[model samples]
Target: MNAEIIGVGSELLLGQIANTNAQYLSKQLAEIGINVYYHTVVGDNATRLKETIHTAQKRADLIIFTGGLGPTKDDLTKETISAVLDKPLVTDEEALQSIESYFKKVNRVMTPNNKKQALVMSGSTILHNNYGMAPGMAIKVSGIEYLLFPGPPKELYPMFENYAKDYLLSKLEIKERIESRVLRFFGIGESQLETEIEDLLEKQSNPTIAPLAGDGEVTLRLTAKHADSKQAKKLIDDVETEILQKVGPYFYGYNQTSLPEELMKHLINEEKTIASAESLTGGLFSERLTSISGAGAVLKGSIVCYHNDVKQHTLGVLNETLNNHGAISVQCAKEMAEQIRIKCCSDIGISFTGVAGPKVQEGKEVGTVFVGIAIEGKETVVHHLQLSGSRQAIRQRSVYYGCHYLLKQLKERD
Candidate 1:
């Protein structure tokens, strides 16, 4: 069934807090084979909330409301919904008793307004809150289902898991499972990736392909629906295989995995140690690697040689090469990579050197980057790139490219 999530709070509109409830509910609904079509956020005003409910009723079979269930007068989620649905609010005896017990245990006097927390829509199934006082409720009006949940995550999460989930499952006539997988790619643009798999996207049926680009990386989320979970996964896998055939070289890891995480996994599996020499990127490459746990097992050290003098003295870059070709050249990158490997006694060494700034360096344009990869007993390779973006973007992309190249080399050995 199609669903719409409505968040009720002025804090969300004012940016005082994020609407994380919508995100969490969307994922949960998707897992149960419900498609979330839209997310609506409205303030505490009852008139606006009533208008939002009207809009949601037109397009969505299921409408879920979060927040505004509290003791204050502003807590009007149930009142607004009851008015919209022409339903009366009645007190849930169990919920009222639970709230009274909580206040007594805490040695606090219960106010008259606190009883409002026990109110539920007439003929609605009450969802007991184990973590907090306000209870949740679900009811159907004119063939559309309406669910009310508390705003706080601590209360909402358990109520949904323990009560709401099973309630929805019992109401479902057809049980279909939705499965999704995310494929991550670097060193490739979204337009190019889409072009390569244009036919698959056009003819998609069981498994739908959606591409998203962010931070110099592209990801495709493939989703499939089936009665059997394994069959749904198989449908996604078949589509993924077809897409990967065209862009396998640039494809890295899967959902929520970063380049550093994948690289660390490879290094740990291969029992290899690595070091880095940073020029334009500072210590970004090493910093990313060290952010992951067990980084000490695979990372030896790093040398930051932002200055020509440091390159010459610390990384042992030849003075003649720096004078003739400059620090941004291929010769300097190769020397930096090789020197760091020797100094750190690591199995692999990577170097990043470039001109990433508002102005050019050594007559080279901004975003002129060179990444060097030196593996033990292998020839050091340097990749020259002319990128475009802000100085920070250039530095970040340079580090990403360094990891990509290193991963490629490691895979080749395998």
Candidate 2:
């Protein structure tokens, strides 16, 4: 089914709040073989929303709305949609009881206006919102289906995943289901990667290949439509295998798996431990590594050797090398990685030393980065990167590259 998403809130228009609901819903709908054609953001104006609804119905088979389901005067999404569909807003007793019980449990009084949140569309499938009081609704009017969800991402995400997706899938009359896989890559530009896979994309038919570039990385989304998911998956896997045959060296992970996540998994699988020595990145590698749960299993510790003195004293870098290399060379990176591994007594050590700046440092131009990795039985390896961005962006990208470097080496040894 071709669908359009409408985000209804003045706050979204004013940039006070982001419309993350559309992103999540689009991904879910795509997985279910629905094609999202348009993303519409409308303020809480009845006339404008009605116009949007009319436009969406004209172009799409399904319309999904997020936001404006709260207990407030400005929440006009349901009011407008009900008017457009000529449907009544009836109180869902189950939702009302849940809201009332929540207020009672918290020892707070429920104002009459709060009941507005429990009012669901008449003759619609009510979506249970276990995470919040607002009930989502799905109804059809004049052959165009509407799925109304709450604005809060926490409430909207689960409601749609558990209830709305199944409801739509059951009603959708399609001969095939679309299956997609996202293959992530590092150390390869989108243009170069696309050039390598140009032939596959040129002759693509049953499965299509699309490339996206973001944050100094590349991603290829492979999508296929087939009657059997198992057969569709095989086709997708075969296509992926063919692509990998050409560019697998740059491939890092799959959908929703990032450099940090994959490194954590490998570390856990290898029963290895790691530590970080930071200079330009200033503990960003450590912070990201520790953010993953069970990271303590693989993460030993880290040292933020930002200053020359800290690098000399904490990470045991030679003063002479710093005086010559200025802490931005491959030699310095290797020493930092080796020192951190020895000091922390871990199986692996990683280091990020760079000049992330608006101006050059120590005769070294900005965006000069060196990521070092030291494994127990392998020689220390240092990878050089010349990146360009803000200081924070450079640091974040350096961290990803650091993980990518380590993962690459680990894969080589494996």
**Who wins the TM-score comparison?**
1
lDDT of 1 by residue, 1-414 (tens): 899999999999999999998999998889889989999999999999989999998999999999999999899999999988999999999999999999999999999999999999999999999999999999998999999999999889989999999999888898899999999999889999999999999999889999999899999999999989999999999999999899999999999999999999999999999999999999999999999998999999999999999999989999999999999999999999999999999999899999999998899999999999999999999999999999999999999988888898889889
Per-candidate TM equals 0.94, 0.90
Error of 1 at 250 (Å): 1.7
Which tens-of-lDDT digit does each residue in 324-386 have in candidate 2?
877999999999999999999999989989899988987788999999988888888999999
Backbone clashes for every candidate come to 0, 0
- The prediction achieving the highest lDDT against the true structure is 1
- Candidate 2 regions exceeding 4 Å error are 88-107, 118-122, 128-131, 161-163
Overall lDDT per candidate, in order of appearance: 0.94, 0.91
